[model samples]
Target: MTDSPEFKDEESIRRGQEFINEVYRKMSRIAEEFAAGEINRAQFHRLYNRYQRQIMTVSQMIAESDPSGWETAVKSDESTLHIRRQFEAKAIGLSIYDNRTGMPIETIGDFSLDAELIVPMLSSYRQATAEIFQAGVRSTEMENGQWLCFMSGAYTTLIVLFSVEPSSNRIMLLDRMHRDFEIANAEFLEHGYTSADQLAYPFYSFIKRSPLDTQDLETELDE
Candidate 1:
């Protein structure tokens, strides 16, 4: 284990506890199988390796959020359409797709730094979502940091990426974004969109005027 700071704020402590709980949740199941002789050492290592990065990341983030060693990240606006976490300049990116065509209709915010890593994960998520939708799951949350959220409409799918650990405020904002998208595009989508550009243009205006501020989150943390 890496050396971490001795002092952590209440929120940081809570996050650390969450990380520990998640570790137990994942490892306990595999440990049971191994102890019962259901899997060999080779299979055990493979299974553990699959989740290692995410688990380690959660640990690392807990350390970084400790006040004694690292700065607590604050969120800020990167651009008119981009909001970023304090640790890095990367901002949460947004995308809309035609569920039937699987073609991207529009994208807001830059995801270039981690685009290579993000695209394939997004693809896998969408595929899983398609299968699960038949079972009445309209939306599902994935990723250890809650960094990505997926939501689907009648004909459109929405993907949101957070460069930071997502907060309830951020998720609530996304809910509003989804609602506005449906209202703004309902007529065009009902009658069939004319073109991708035409369908996506309205969203630009809506998002620009919408609340993407993270000040509320920062204030909550302060309390």
Candidate 2:
């Protein structure tokens, strides 16, 4: 990383050294979370990439002030932080509803946001919007910039509320979770009536698998 004339002072380098410690410390939290099974690989990569980009910008400054300090800065950064988790979009709520009666079957996380966002739209959930949802997971932007995403299943609909717009990758993961949830409880879900206790919570597995490991999603290129 070459210096671009901005961070070419002793004071700038000193401040940068301190800041990089904080940044790398944040990275350490995610790294530790990934290792401890608190977060999955995809979530780690998404968050780590965001912070790593900042490293690049800071690298230039460090180089401008003292090229030799770049390597030291890296060593200081990879050291994990003991502080609390700082980043990653919040999984605010998750809800599962009966397709036939449009009644909620189960809910996890915060779904109060759902009551407000879902109720008014329930009336418009008629035939007109049915086709739009047939493809895959669909998301609606909330007033506070949050995202309310839902995927329909054979007998139920799974909705996830997030603090940010879920990425296409995350959507794909939710689709898999929905399919697995339906398959695991197909007999129960397809039956005339069943209670939530009798069914398995495959969607909850989504937290552990977050976007699912890339390798887990891979298949042979050919036979």
The candidate scoring highest on TM-score is 2
Task: In candidate 2, list every pair of residues with a backbone clash.
Answer: none
Q: Give the distance in Å from residue 169's predicted Cα in candidate 1 to where it truly belongs.
A: 2.9
Q: Give the TM-score of candidate 1.
A: 0.41
lDDT by candidate, in order shown: 0.53, 0.67
Candidate 2 local lDDT, residue 132: 70
Residue-level lDDT tens digits of model 2 in 1-223 = 9765555565566766777778789889878866665654446776777678657867795676564455465555432232113333456778888888888888876667637668565535534357675655667778887778877777887878877665565677778888888888888878746587787776655553343344544553332
Sequence-dependent TM-score of model 2: 0.56
Residue 65 miss distance in model 2 (angstroms): 4.7
Model 2: how far residue 44 lies from native, Å: 12
Candidate 1 lDDT, 14-57, residue by residue in tens: 76567557756777776786676444344455556544644555
At residue 94, what lDDT does model 1 achieve? 69
Off by over 4 Å in 2: 1-65, 72-87, 122-129, 207-223
